[model samples]
Target chain A: MNTRFILVLLFLFLFMPCPSQAEMGMGISGRTEALVIEQFPYVYEGRFSIHNTSDTACLYVLAVASPYEDVTEWVAVSPAAVEIASNGYADIKYTIAAPGGYTGDYDIRIIANGYALSGEGTTGDRPVSYLQTSGSLRISVNVTHNAGDASLGTTRPHEADAPAAEDPQPVDVGSQAYLDVPTDVSVGTAVRLRGGIIGHEAPASLCIVLSSPMGESYALPTDYTYTFREEGVWTARLTLPDAPLVERQIRVRPVRAAGMAGGAYAVAGGLLLLGFLALHRERKKGQKRREKSEARHQTTLSSISLKSKTLEGREMPKGL
Target chain B: MYQKTRITALIAILALLTIPFVWADSESVSATAGINPYAPSFEYVEITDTELSISSHLDVDREYYLHVHSIDKNGITDIASLVCTLFFAGDGSLSAGATDTRSCYTLTYTYANGTANWTSAPAGHLVEGDCSATPDGYRSRFIFAFSLGKIAIPSGDTNTWKVSVTIMDRSGQTTTYADLPFDVNDYIEWSGVPSTLELSSTCMDPESPWTLPQSQPVQAVVTSNVPVSVLFCGADLMYGADAIACETFTLETVATPAGGTVNTAYAIPGAIPTESVTLVDTAYGTACMLDPTLAGYCNNSAGIASFVIDAATGATVPYVPAGTYSAVWTFTLERGAGVTP
Candidate 1:
């Protein structure tokens, strides 16, 4: 029975939360973990979270410090002393004033020193002893001048270079396919779309669905070329409308081109066809008039031959 | 029961180790201190009151002033004496082979009600003093005038000087303040004809279109003390009054009879009368001549550029007011073709 009791107590010690373990430590966190400031003759205001991680009430002294002596001289901390309740947190404020005509990098750190109150109900001016569980947290602040060049190390790469998502799993849309389309296009300009089936077999039919900036979708013919009249960000999607396959969408930015409008080409083509039809009709009318003239001459020759034959018969009777 | 007692002892030891110990208490004073501000600052003023000319030589006989005073703040606490020293750098030699050097001069002034006594010291040495008297008011002002000849500066050398003023209080606290840079040089000389050009009001009329004079002869002769590879000469039209109506003017170098060349005319599209405008910039013009030897200098005579007022408006607005508009024509002589001396 004693052994069993010891085993049960050990299990309870392992599972139960210990109050003494929670009562003896301090912690500090910053609202602004890192700062990037530009320009001089400027002021920066920051706040930090200071908590008594221990279970007992504690007194804390907050101070603004820096590795750079010049920065330390310019930084000011408010509410330098505070009393935090057990397992409670407090916020401290700090201000940094940068002098004019000085351009360089400045790193600042905010330090909170935790101590044990010497007496109960201790308020201001209470002597405190340093705590063994005191903690130090550092919040890095970077300050620079506007006229100076910004450090390029903090910049991120362009989002366009990110790898494209893998092709969606094939659905019931006939055979799988992929699309090859330009990511950039100009408004009122013709763009070509080229794609083929995933395998050697060609799909029964393939079409393109264009989603415009106005949230409108268009079902375009299978023609490889298309011209967008509107100017904005558009998404060109290649899909098999008859088949149940996933469609591929590509982003495009359409810009307005100079000179003739898209409709101008259609109008010019219509005018050329109209001119050719008019010329062909005029030539057909000239040929019909020539055939009529030839028939009339042939009739005239036949009438002359008939009259000559009658005159010769009359002249032969008179001579007998 | 024995095992439980041992576990309890182990837990107590761990708790004791985690808790911080408090030593014997003793009575002590706990005081909080704040930052203290102390110091008496003053502003400095140059006594010459004129813009320093780079080309004109400084005359050693003329007295120059260095004034320091505090109008807002009180003077140094219980001031006993104020000593002023002027330091000269790059003033030593202009010889073709001499190395540059620096030197300093000191002059101590004794405190009085409104006046002070000056005691000059040898060059490169400081003169120390402790006058018993003090100024009547809390605000203090000191003016020191000294001649450049006393500094032993070599001829034809360019010199830069700065002044440091030190104040000693009764408690022996000494604070020194340094002034801005002041330059003095002796290099180039130039002279112009007609000393001054007066453009009559009749030449500037709203009713009649105006043109520059073609016959009135005006010229300038520029000479340099040292050899220069190229020479740049121009004139700035300094107006006497603020413009009321128009803001356009033109000046052209029409003729150069003394082997000088003329380039495109200088035109001011929108000029402010209160500010000076360059009527001619010969630096980039045909007037600039190259000397391959780098030993030749500018000693040639160039014609004075002609001026036409309110011509750039192109009949868009009325000519400048009928008042007798006066302008000062100041000529500039630079060393290189496009460089300012």
Candidate 2:
């Protein structure tokens, strides 16, 4: 076992001096994640780059698509097809014309299909073969027509989005997904909430509709301080575009003065004073009974003495 | 003869000094204090290509300029601070408030054999390329090489950019390459249309009046150079003496939400003699978005343009004179966003 271990260590040490080799492949290193626009009907200038570190020059064809949108038609690339020299790079440029009227978010995928130059051209056309190698990047197209629509979350470009169900409503959506509201707050304390589309991406401004205790909703006034004046478990409901219905209840606690309530203190003080008066009255009654019993004892003793004196007088006379 | 000998000695000293200057291109630096006056300059042989010209000099209206390069080595090194901080100078047109910002980048290299190496620029610095400088013994001088080739100009910046480059050595001495001006173009175009729409007797129903979709939708391209809108209209369909009025058809993108009635987003105007009606609009005139369920926020992605016939007018398929109705349809592209009232 020692000999085998020694041989393995020697073999690894000998190979450590050699430099590691790289493989022929492709990678993209540019704005692969986002292209968010607002108040469109204007152009959006975008860019990305392709790195083909292969020995032989390869040609790349680019394609943009989305499963649910026509983003491919909305975008155009200057050099949709490019030829990168060996160990070289090709910079790509694309434009997105965000139209007005309708507003929402979209996920656009830019796919680069690469092919070897020498492959096949029997008909003099670029040879089409089985996909040799490819690189792709997903760009989240977050467009809003409203100047100040809050977008709390941008799409995760790398991961595939959860497929939306038909008649997609926020039936199972949590309030935290749409609005960020506190579960607990003190009376007269301002409830600072932020929401439009809630997640990581911080939006500049949010459109809010605060619900009344009576279940009526009103566009929360800009200068409206969201303070809870009274104490109760009040529920506020909010609705967003595409029917994301989220309702959350906040437990509003009454204001405490110096860790105690004034009303409680008043009730406690009144109860203590009533008890003191009742005890004082009871003591007076007991004192009066004691005095009466002492007077009765005095009268009975005097009467007994008089009776005794008479009996003594009679007895004395009899004895004489 | 004594005077001539002194002049010859001076001449010999001068001849010996010119030897290093003559072979300075390939010559190694000596224990000398100063370098060649033109050793690291923009006017050097390898610095031949100075102008980073546009690809299409004739066409002055395209949004992006891909990979503008001056690959000619202009021997200087250690570039710091690459900022892409020029916004629309025309007017603050892009101010939609806070999320209106561009991106920052860095550079990394991978070898032909796949050995990856990181070449860094501080995060948020804009340039994306490899920059290297190796010192060649001289405390005051180092050999520098740059392979930078990218600048994505946004369409809103309509004016020329006057850029200035400054290079500094470790010894605090500097070289200045002044005034490299770059001009960008602005333009917009799109392609790919859907198959034809078919109309028939089965077109009208009071409950769900939308007709069966005939074909694919118009594939709209996104671009930053110019804003656009798609409009559609057709003549009256006539079948063997039977004529159907054009107002009977409607084009819309979104389906009606449950319980609430959904109106067609962009409806076609009256046929032929009637002015064209805008379908794909840039002036957020109609709905909030294309599909709220698909994208969480306010997004305007294009949807299938479905045609619906009006049943509210009391014209059912049986009540109207219907046959194989046909009319020539024409779609037009027009200036949108900025031009819309």
Candidate 3:
């Protein structure tokens, strides 16, 4: 038995290079080479590359841990980490817990182990990692703090804007301003408004919110009011309402509107009167000229007939 | 008399209203009936043939000239400008050159097997050809060689081209030559790298901020005249204890995000890496979600995620498998500490 054992030992020594080759042959590299974590005061995760370097195929196991104590209070344990495989390499991913008040620098590292197993009767070779020769991967963590706040304030300019503000009734002392009709009425018969206009030319329209005393409300047409350019000349006129309103207690607000009927009538009457007087005056002058011409013609004709009669009488006496 | 007087007054009023009396009579007359509407017309060439045939091994250091001339509706012959593009077929190669002549181009070639030649020269007479060998099809192709000065076109300009030869017959007939085939690749050299980039990530969140870790950064840069956008980046993550989670960050090619903005991403289909690596530790009942503040975590969720293709590059650098992973991944997208939600 001793002689056979010696012979076996010699054989083993001669072919021992195969085992070394197999050990170096089986290996794997992680697929991912980079990661970005951006949650502040929260847990961050990263992945490491695992490459298979040995000739014999083998499974890989990966582990991650905190390389720095001061940077983080919590460390990444077993369940929180993951290992994956592709092409001969496995990836070991690590997640760090959220350190709410944590700031500054911290190092994260990942370690991978590769192993090859054979036979049903015997266990496999012990798993090993390329940590020492291949070197471990480390990541830099930067925790930032929040600064102060900056804001913008409201300082807007104020010009003239009606309706947005309260709509107040304009007051005039002397000139009459048109007031909106209390009741709605059709065209032809003008309903009088009670407000006064302070300018000479009436404006086109004004806005009035009218509501029925019974709770019903309607926005009066803004086109119903008129505006005047001149200052301090107030006047009011009756207006033709668009439609008839059944309610008598309709709330009416005075708004400026153009004079509807009075100015039009005055203009028409003045033009008609001036035209008639001029025509009559022209006809009279024509008649006087005709009369003078007729009188002159009659005078001339009478003088000629009288001379002819005198001549005839003188001739008759001479013949006798 | 009264009627005539009234008539005269009515006519005067009508004439006053109709005539533009404010303008001088000479100016008004000239403005109203100035030009003759039935004027003589002329014709022009609208389009040109976009195809050409040259030697695949053609030397790009030399100049090549192509000429095209068209006849108008009145049978007046006029020169036409042809803008052509040259491409290679098998091992695709392209090169472009400059020329000194009115209708010639000096071809520069960078790609090996084939050549592409075109001109950026002034307009000149275009050579017209009849491809009667081919039928009345959209494909019109012909091969011709002419020497103006010492510009010699090699013999094998046949196989690698699709020429679009338009002919303006002497009778003022305009025809379009489309999809013509060619024998050789005209040599042209294009310098400088691509001007765009494509960026992709397995997991991403728009609401959360993102940062690339110094260790696993997915960055490809172009140092020279080449634009970085032409570069493509792809990433994969293995799920489980070391669950794979990767984020790809790409710089916006455009200077501003809101101005003449450029797109910077392309989403690759079925290329997302989302497997979970886990220890299956049922005994320890701890459900650890991916930390938003962690590096490489696309999200705290447990599914495989892939990034869309970057608008800049068309490459997917690292690709991973897809599935629900048992492993936990933590990513932290924390903004400033006091950042409001």
- Candidates in order have lDDT scores of 0.42, 0.39, 0.28
Could you tell me the lDDT of residue A84 within candidate 1?
A: 79
Work out the TM-score per prediction: 0.20, 0.28, 0.19
Best by lDDT: 1
Report the lDDT of model 2 for residue A314.
Answer: 73
DockQ of each candidate's interface versus the true one? 0.00, 0.01, 0.00
Per-residue lDDT of candidate 1, residues B284-321 (tens digit) = 22222322113332323232333333333442323443
Model 2, span A194-258: residue lDDT tens = 34322223233334566545565555522234887666666543443323233345666766641
| CAPRI-style quality class for the chain A–B interface of candidate 3 | incorrect
Backbone clashes in model 2? 30
Interface RMSD of each: 39.3, 21.6, 30.4
Q: Which scores better on lDDT, 2 or 3?
A: 2
Worst 10 residues of 3 chain A by lDDT: A119-128
Which DockQ value does candidate 2 get? Answer: 0.01
Q: How many Å off is the CA of A139 in candidate 3?
A: 1.4
